[model samples]
Target: MTAEPPLLALPLHAAAPTGAPAARSFTTQLPGDPRALYLSRVWVRRIVTVLCWRGDVLRAVEAVTRLVDNGVRHGIPSSVPPPEQQLTLSIATDDTGSLIIDVADLNPAFPDFEAAVSGERGCGLWQVASLGARVTRFLPHEGRGKTVRAVLAPGPVGL
Candidate 1:
């Protein structure tokens, strides 16, 4: 059998000094396709791994997976023009060091927010909240769509 390729090591990112928050953000636009869900997970994992944040990377990946899936399913309108049938994913760190994950999509309606937050709706949002993320959403100033944002506390939860 052919030898498998050796694993590649990720470069080390210098840790931000204590009390000095690092502000960085990454954003990408993905088409409203089921395939974009996979891209979302990969994006979160790669970013988390590269940043070396203290929070659990898997948790972030899981949360992002659900959010992107929701955007692709509920946020993309079948009647919308092709140019407007995509969503935006963003990851950033706030001044308090919390990791923020935001997914913005074309549909402004999110009628199940309450149900989802309460676990009454099965959108996997409750699971994200159970992972210690504070999930919330807002409409952009232009009011074309909504953005679902989940903030993960710095460091792993349940400490």
Candidate 2:
């Protein structure tokens, strides 16, 4: 099969209005690559920017980059077909403007935060967990993929 095509982040301002609830969900398809990691971070920043929560933009970017980077590195096997190797990312905010980010890929090998957090400071998962986010859970979809989700609450709250 062929290498997967790239997925650029959608326009930042395309999100709901600035003062509106940042609750709308956005999804994008991604290929497995280094650029995917960088672009994913940019995407998170842009989304948070639209929500008028510029403070959490950097933290959100770092957290999302770590999560999506894990997906690219561990969630998709190189042997899988290009089409089958795709990753899907979903982002939204709750009524209170809590930002939620989810990244899914074909591998069922979900990132075990518990395993990664065995008191290790360097673990990416741990870094994500420490980002002042209220992590809901990691959910494995019925058959094809698993999703990792983290939530960062609105303004002056999320560091």
Candidate 3:
């Protein structure tokens, strides 16, 4: 009989600094199975609602969906059973009036945002970048998986 693949794991950031404003974070682990994509979206929407973001829910949702989709598309090992893969989503607000969202996965392949847009099949990061927000990718370290973070702010002059 084939052995079941091991579960994918992602570590949460160490607790925030002392006396820092509470930045909320939520995490969900879904089996790498096909249904994981659908589960990820539901978790994302719940996180947004818990944060009480009053503006641009559509943009925020799109950003997260793209990130999660990228995780599923690039992070999972082809040989691993879908139930063995995992995806993690984290959201936080800082003192600078910016909301920072991070999506992490055990997959090691870094996405080529430029190439994706040029290829006409994926435009997730490009859309996030076009929002005038900053997006960055963090490589795995100390046995952790990769993370992609999107930093968004209320438009200048509070548009």
Candidate 4:
């Protein structure tokens, strides 16, 4: 494994072109330690709650928990220094108003998406997909790491 470029913090607000939906996003980096699993869960729940998404908050939290757990377990290479092992968590709303949860880690390899979706692999991703989340992986522009993304319908609106 190679050294990962530091993740940048995106500004909270950005300009969107005409006819384009404005993006609402939040991002944070956490140590790639096991405790990140629990912290990710809490962070997602709080973000969803703040977004006023009451209907699917639990599902979102569960999905994030699994994804972050995967990152901490498989994405961290022991060859890297402890301080360098970090993961980024991002929550955002796409143009369609769906919730997007992304967990990025230093590993470029991805889980077998097809097998995980088919329940042939581990249950973590299977359960996430079963919750109506569209799970996918992509290499960030920097090419240092890959991000596992889960997109889900935001569910009913909250007051």
Clashes of each: 0, 0, 3, 0
Candidate 4 or 2, higher lDDT: 4
Task: Give one digit per residue, the lDDT tens place, for model 2 in 41-64.
Answer: 666666666556534687888888
* lDDT for each candidate structure: 0.75, 0.65, 0.62, 0.73
Task: Give lDDT for model 2.
Answer: 0.65
lDDT of 2 at 80: 91
Model 4, 49-156: lDDT tens digits are: 665653478888888888888889888888879979998888776566677778888998765867976679888888888888878777776647788877777674
For residues 70-95, could you state the per-residue lDDT of candidate 1 as single tens digits? 89888988889877688888777656
As for lDDT, the candidate ahead, 1 or 2, is 1
Tell me the lDDT of model 1 at 66: 86
Candidate 1 at residue 112, lDDT? 73
TM-score of 2: 0.73
* Poorest lDDT segment (10 consecutive residues) of candidate 2: 11-20
TM-score for all models, in order of appearance: 0.80, 0.73, 0.69, 0.81
Model 2 residue 126 distance off true place after TM-score fit, in angstroms: 0.5
* Shift of residue 123 alpha carbon in model 3, Å: 2.1
Alpha carbon lDDT at 19, candidate 3? 31
Please give the range of 10 consecutive residues that has the lowest summed lDDT in model 4: 11-20
